[model samples]
Target: MKKIDVIVKYFYPLAAGIEINVRNVYKHMVSHGWDVTIHTSTDMPEAKNSLPVIDHLDGMNIHRYPWRWYGFVPRIDWAHTPAIALHNFNIFPHSWLLIIVLIRRTLGMSSPKVFLTPHGGFTPEWRTFSPLSRFIKKTYQEILGVHLINAAVDGLRSVSDWEAVESIKHGMRPDIIHIIHNGLEREVYTQIEKLANQVTTDQVRKLGRYLIQIGRIHPIKNQATGIKALKHLPQDIQFVIIGPVTDPEYKKSLDLLISQLGLFDRVHFLGVISGVNKYYWLRHSVVNVHMALWESYCNVIHESMSQGCVCIVSRGTALEELIKDKINGFCVPEYDEVSVADAVKYILDSSHARQILAMRKRNTDFTRGHSWQNISLQVEKMYTTALGS
Candidate 1:
């Protein structure tokens, strides 16, 4: 572990799970005088033409390459990094980089000690896709994904125990998998601490009474569940949705459903918010309802809880680990419409005000303990294990 470099195909500052994980964790590593470098893609849709190909900041070497097709990036000949970490989700860098490692190992080229953190990469949920898409995923996961990992990867960094099963299904060794969850940024908690006092009457009026679902609009995310839950809540409380529409068709279906229910006025969609604006909305909201079908790990859950907002998350996924069925917060059975509605209504009911406040207190205490500084130490141990030092 002489030099620590991370590879994530799509890297942005202070956004998304993988990007934020890299920014927070590696910055701590850099402060400790560890050699931290990040290799990422120059395909930032938000920045368009603004990002430079090469830059250096926060005591790290930032290298950006043009992404051509299907997570493909042109390789540059630079000094080798002995230890490399791959941040993965459904696709991109991990899937593509795995192929590179396979080819390199097959050609008898020198291989780095690679560790992979699979944030929901190649999971069983892909079976829900269309036949052609399913075939492509199956072929990749069973054939390429497994072989590449077995050939080159030295260890696995899993965010939760739930994902260890998914990693094993893809043929990763269980003993080598490290269960290290993501953590909240210190600044985020700083903002929450500032809100310990009551907000003014005007400030409360401005924020409005609402429940929020913050994530990309996708069918797999099950945003429709939130809409259905809204039908059970009171009329004054609108459902605030803040995330980009990654799937327009799904968004259209939600619009149609809202029209059918005649609740157009009660459902507000504010796409892709960040920084304090997003936090203010979450902090002042009535509650946060997230019913995504599957997740390797969810950062929004931690963010919502840290702000003392009660969360109603789905069960049988990584969310269960976060919202421990009334231990900290609530977990409705996933896709059970009646159960979901009942849970939301129960928390919102005036009779249960004391109970909900207790839950909020427990949630904030639990979430506050998981800061990035704590997570960095766990990640450094994973790196050391992977490097066998």
Candidate 2:
């Protein structure tokens, strides 16, 4: 099999789920005897001084491109503006290197089967979020980004069917859309589970029953709604919001809402816990709640479920496909505070029922078809098909 050159915008140090996915895919494909090289932006200062070059990491080659620095942007103000500005100003510049690399490869200067996974870039929610910015993005997508990506790649990979559909809506060629769910490494999942079980014995004694919500602290995630749902819950139960404080203003607003609802003590903001702590919290919590308005596919939901933590996700999108109501987990109407509260309360009150459902639905085998090894095999097939091999 020939080597595959994968191009992505930026990765690492951010600890975003998409970054993790990119890293895992690169690692797994190399392990499977496929020559895989990733092109990404470099964090190195000296590399930033250079333009249109390649930087090597371990045995994996990462091509670096100069990105324009937008210095000292206030987080609060930026959050209100279109998310695309964040992407355009920082991430999109790296993508322009794709054209340079493609031209070089066409001129017989480089050789590899090329593949592109834009991560969540092709989604409608991201495109539709800002009007003027959306127009700019749409123009870029149609003329430069989409066409270049289609022409440059041997295959297109999506994290979910939702992503594929969204890409098609934006006019991507249908035959090229390949669905591959992001996966949890088996070893990592095992380590987390073992650590979680040990911590459950210690933490369950102190925390009692609680709900866990994990993601970036942002308006789209609807943390305020979770806080509101706590107001409707009995005093004995609590809600724990975990993950990085990505938006300070949104965090402040959530704090104010919690205070107004008088849930200061009841709702806890455990900012960005990971490693053993993340697993421990997931293991001890009675259920996981994801109230985000949009998701291509959530790693948290799959990870929690793999750990036997029942989830309450919002209806619509790929979430509906993952969760079946009252079975493995529950799906309440999106943004319905009452429904969310009622669902949480029912799960808390009926521990035995929740446990039974969880046990039945619990997936201990993280290496099931969703593993990156398996997904990469499927990606390899797509590459072969695209090459007409």
Give the Å error, residue 388, model 1: 5.2
Compared with the true structure, all predictions reach lDDT values of: 0.75, 0.65
Candidate 1 residue spans exceeding 4 A from truth? 44-52, 55-57, 74-79, 89-96, 99-109, 191-204
Angstrom error of the Cα, residue 85, model 2: value is 22
- Candidate 2 residue-wise lDDT, 1-389, digit = tens: 44655444455444556666767666765676655555455543223433345555435666554444522212122112111111212235434444644776678764344456666665645522678878866677777777766675556778788788878887788876678787765544456545555544565557677888988787767777777888788787888888776668788898888878888778878666665667668766877888778777888777676667777888876786667788677888777888888877777665567564654355444325566667657766776676555
Best by TM-score: 1
Model 2's alpha-carbon lDDT is 0.65
Of the candidates shown, which would achieve the greatest lDDT relative to the real structure?
Answer: 1
TM-score of structure candidate 1: 0.85
What TM-score against the true fold does each predicted structure earn? Answer: 0.85, 0.77
lDDT of 1: 0.75
